[model samples]
Target: MSTGAAADGGVHDFGCRGGDPAASAVSGRVSGTGEGKVRSLAWNQGTTLLRAWRAGVLPRRKKLLMTNTNAPSSAASLGLLVLRVVVGAIFAAHGAQKIFEYTIPGTIGSFADMGVPLAEIAAPVVAFVELIGGILLILGLLTRPVGIVLAIDMAVALILVHLPAGLWVGDGGYEFVAVLGVAALALALTGAGRFSVDGAVLRGRAPAWLS
Candidate 1:
């Protein structure tokens, strides 16, 4: 079984598949920052730590060899899968409401009322971005770019519609949009996990970056 940690200092994973991964983890003693505390993740084993093996590095398992992480970390992939589905669902629903319920013209009217410049352009752009980008995010296709776009969309909404009310959602404040924006931004930075289409195609290959 693989393991992962949340943003908190504590580690989390699927409970008890067969063996005691926790015991093995303790024996290994949380090498480097995988101990948690949410720092920058190294794409591969630190070169400094692997210096001795540089001359004759032997291949391990196929997936492990392909991915950035040095060890199996299925739990983190699962966490990312969960995040993508939930956030994408919310985005898709809102997009559907704007497209079907409000209709493009009605959405344009709303945008005009809100004093958004170029409502004719902004309305459809926002609508399709939410709908198409949400679907892409759910499928984990082109995840990094989609995440970045969605984050910008929400940022615009937060600044234009919600910020005046302050932080409380009850007051039609920025809290909700802020959360959505930050979540999308996080995905942009991290990319979808190994369960994604990006992972399948890219396979952590020649370019160390770009999900």
Candidate 2:
């Protein structure tokens, strides 16, 4: 007798003794005696599968899934909130120094000494913009507009006072102002994120333009 196995591990015995050839081929086993056909249909099927795989007729498949962690997750929103508060605080402190510690007149004199144009008008306006804009940024109220204004203010500072000094803040260069401007521009583009007044009020209903 001969034996064969199916792909599922089932075995069939083909007794090669005293059996009708037609019956053995159709029933996959011998009749009237233990003898059966020389080959099993299961073995042929398995070989066909292997040949197909080898020939690339039945290639294996792989599955993949992708996710964007930076696209406004909860943690990302928290980070944005932290950035807003820190940058806002720094701006507010600078504004306070100019408006109170130095006094508006003294700040204007200082700007004029630095060769800043329209020192009298620009000094007071920059002071108030920094103070009020910083507060709004920290609170995440009207964040986009406030951020845009603050960015513009930093750009003016860079052009008027810091550009000529080069990149180092210690040498009165534009590096610090440039960084602040970039941060403000980021806020304007990304909005205040989830932990903000806008987020709370909108409750996931915010339009694309707003957040």
Candidate 3:
């Protein structure tokens, strides 16, 4: 025969062929007393504890998961801001050198030497675009359109001046122009990010093209 203790502290016997009188008496006493009620109360308390633990732990886990996911996006916004500012500064410096230091006539002469078509007209136009666009880029004003214009300008310089020299900038190659062009293209596609004037002005309600 196998014997086991019940939740009510009663002993039960299995395989009692003759139906053991002692086991039957103990079962009747437990059922008639307050032990069964005490067991029910303990079971309810255990169930309540389990439910409370789940309620407390689940929200905490969800919050931790959300924090981990959001961290990378915050870092990306900062990265984009850094990229925009640095590239804008470089373009601005180059533009200032061409317009102020080199002089328009000198720039035209250089363009002519480089075999640029319509050097006289193209020289002033390129200089103006670079100077004004660079300033606008730094201010994050009209970012996407300005980025497109700068990208095209760099692409032209690459095709006409740098491509023939090869890939290394030290050898007068297209490396610098290619990098500038790709950066401009990226800006054109991504816009200025949350740190930009565009973001401040738009306030997350901008049109698709503007962004």
Candidate 4:
């Protein structure tokens, strides 16, 4: 005799009577028991296989499905986190030096000498963008908008300042500024990841404009 319990707490037993191995009878029923108790009892022997699959006892197929579904998002999140920190630190240091005279021009007059066009206007503006954008980028707050502005700022530098020198860093060319512009543009296109303040705000509620 073989026995089992059903989900609704009913008990079932299967047994053979007399000398017939093929001839089987259930005590309170027939070839089956449990009497409507086994709600998930699938109709065929193949049902056992299906149950095993639902329980994750089948590894090969499940693994393939999980891998294909989740891998790309994981990789992108990692890439975004890396880019955020590196870019932030680079901007912060450059801005600090300009703003505080820690390394370069103490004020607008020195910047004018460096041929930064209209230094009276451009110096403070550039310093504010670099300083404020760097801080926001590091905190991952308002990442998309900040990234957009920073990207534009870098693009302007590449066009107005660096392009005159050609392509090589040795030639004071567009190489560095162009690369920075692209990085900021990429961040603008994709918001910060789950580890960011921007992500927290996004999860709470959709921004008004997003609706």
Q: Which candidate is the best by lDDT?
A: 2
lDDT of 1 by residue, 118-184 (tens): 9999999999999998888888888888999999999999888889899999998999989989988
TM-scores vs. true structure, each candidate? 0.66, 0.64, 0.64, 0.60
TM-score of 4: 0.60
Candidate 4 per-residue lDDT over residues 22-117, each given as its tens digit:
453334554245645464455554788888888888887888889776433766777887898889877877778778873334557766765778
The best candidate in terms of TM-score: 1
Query: Model 2, which residues run further than 4 Å from truth?
Result: 1-71, 202-211
User: Least accurate stretch of 10 residues (summed lDDT) in model 3?
Assistant: 10-19
Clashing pairs in 3: none
Q: Give the TM-score of candidate 2.
A: 0.64
Query: After superposing candidate 1, which stretches have Cα over 4 Å from the reference?
Result: 1-72, 204-209
**Which order, best to worst by lDDT?**
2, 3, 1, 4
lDDT against the true structure, each candidate: 0.80, 0.83, 0.83, 0.73
Between candidates 1 and 3, the one scoring higher on TM-score is 1
Error of 2 at 14 (Å): 35
Evaluation by lDDT, superior candidate among 3 and 4 = 3
Q: How much lDDT does candidate 2 score? A: 0.83
Count of residue pairs whose backbone atoms collide, per candidate: 0, 6, 0, 1
